[model samples]
Target: MATIFTRIVEGEIPSYKIAETDQFLSFLDVRPTVEGHTLCIIKREVDYYFDLTDDELAGLTLFSKRVAQALKQVIDCKRIAVAVLGLEVPHTHVHLIPVRSEQDFHLGRSIEVSPERMEEIAAAVRAALEG
Candidate 1:
């Protein structure tokens, strides 16, 4: 069965995509921890992060680094912190969240964002990525 991340990659599920390559995809986190919280995942479905082959792992991180750089260009945060906790869904993925302080990493402390705002943010990130 395809994981949720795979579904997003395959267009079976919708996503606010930030970037895409042959092997990876990045998108805005619908339940963002911060304003520009994004999720990066390998195109292939893998249950565990450590289970990915070395090449796949490298590709995912490199792709995410590019997304993080683009994310920082638009979001007003000190830095983008990466987290790889896969328990939420059965897909190996990375969370690139904008953080100004230690408290910003609190995943449970998500703020509600309107769908229009989400589209706006997603467009900003996409423009940054393209620029």
Candidate 2:
């Protein structure tokens, strides 16, 4: 079966896409830990992140680096935190979250942003990438 991220890429499921390339896809996390929380996934399905071939792993990180840079331009946080706990879904994915402090990493809770805010954030990220 295709992973949920693949389904999102296929448009079988909807996503608030932030950016994409031939090998990577970045989008907003529905159950986000922070307001600008994003998820970047490799096009291929790997059960674990480290399971990816070295080149694939490098490419994913490179792709996410760009996403993080864009996030920095768009979000108000001090920095973006990357977390790779692969238990949330079966797919190999990276989390890009805006963090003001280490306390923001706690997955125990999440704050939902309104639709207008989501769109505003997306546009800011997009503009950053294009700028």
Candidate 3:
């Protein structure tokens, strides 16, 4: 069975896409920790983040860094916080949250964003990645 992240990577499920490459994909989290919160995942479905091959792991980190940089361009924050909980979903993913203070790191305190706003934020992040 394919994981939900696999479904998103394959377009079986829709996502507010931020960036993509042959090996990885970055997109907005439906339940955002902050307005610019994003998720980065490997195109390959891996159950654990560490289970990825060394090269795959390195690629994921570099790819995530690019996405984080683009995210920073649009989101005002002291830094982009990276989190890898891997408990909410079966697939491996990295959460990139724009953080200004300790409160911004609260994963439990997710915010509900409308579809329109999601689209807008995704576009901004995508544009930043492109430009």
Candidate 4:
């Protein structure tokens, strides 16, 4: 069975996309810790982050950096925090969270964001990436 992230990449599941490349995809986290929390994932179905090859790891990091840069431009935060926890989804992914302080980076908590607001944030990040 394909993981949810793979489903998103395959168009089986809808996502508020922030950015994409031939090998990677970044999109808004529906259950976000913050308003601008995003997920960057490798298109391939890799179970663990450490299981990825050096090149794959580097590519994902570079791809995520671009998304983080764009995310920072649109979201008001001190820094974009990165986290990798593969237990929940069984796919290699990175969380790029916009944080005002250290407390904002907590992975155990999430905030409710409406669909309209998610799209708006996604659009702003996309525009930032493009501009």
Candidate 5:
């Protein structure tokens, strides 16, 4: 069976997409740590991030930077923090959070957003990419 991330990549699953290229996709995290938290994933389903090619790795970071900058333009944050913890899904992904303090990126004390809030956040983040 394809992983959930692969399904999203293949459009079998829907997402509040932020940015995409031939090799990467950026979207809002459904269970966001912060209001504008985003998920940046490689097009390929690599379990570990370091398994990606140098070019792919660099491109992913650069692509994420573009999205982070856009998030900053629209979301309130002191800075945008990026985290990589490949334990949840079989695919490699970076979690980008709009942070206000050292604890803002604290994966332990993160906020659980409601579905309605997720929709609202998705709209804002999507607009940020366009704006």
Candidate 6:
């Protein structure tokens, strides 16, 4: 069975997309730690982050950096925190969280963001990437 991230990549599941490339996709985290929390994932169904090839890892990091840069432009934050926890979802993903301090990036913590706001944030980040 395809993982949820793969389903998003395949268009089976809807996502508020920030950016995409042939090998990567960046989108808003529906259950976000902060308003602008985003996830950058490899299109391929890789189970673990360390299991990816050196090139794959580099490509994902570079792709994520682009998204984070755009994310920072639209979201107010001191820095964009990055995390890789592959347990919840089998597919490899990088979490780019906008944070003001140490307490802002907890994995189990999430804040409710409405659908309209999610799309608005997604649109703003996408525009930042293009502009």
lDDT (Cα, tens digit) per residue for candidate 2, span 1-131: 88888899888998788899998899888887889999999988888998999999999999999999999988889999999988978889999989999999877688888877887888789789888
TM-score of 3: 0.97
**TM-score of model number 6:** 0.98
Which is superior by lDDT, 2 or 3?
A: 3
Candidate 1, residue 112: how far the Cα is off, in Å: 0.8
The runs of at least 3 residues in candidate 4 whose Cα sits more than 4 Å from the true structure, single-residue gaps closed, are none
* Distance from true location, Cα of 98 in model 3, Å: 0.5
TM-score of each: 0.95, 0.95, 0.97, 0.98, 0.89, 0.98
lDDT of candidate 6 over 13-91, digit per residue (tens): 9999999999999999999999999999999999999999999999999999999999999999999999999899999
Q: Rank the candidates by lDDT, best first.
A: 6, 4, 3, 1, 2, 5
Question: Each prediction's Cα lDDT score?
Answer: 0.90, 0.89, 0.93, 0.96, 0.86, 0.96
Clashing pairs in 4: none
Model 1 clash count equals 0
Q: RMSD per prediction, one decimal? A: 1.0, 1.0, 0.8, 0.7, 1.6, 0.6
1 against 4, candidate with superior TM-score: 4
For residues 1-131, could you state the per-residue lDDT of candidate 1 as single tens digits?
87878878989999888888888898989889889999999888898999999999999989999999999999999999999999989999999999999899988778888888888888998998889
Identify the leading candidate in terms of TM-score.
6
Give a tens-digit lDDT track for model 4, residues 14-130.
999999889999999989999999999999999999999999999999999999999999999999999999889999999999999999999999999999999999999999999
- The TM-score, computed over Cα atoms with residue i paired to residue i, of candidate 2 is 0.95
RMSD of 1: 1.0
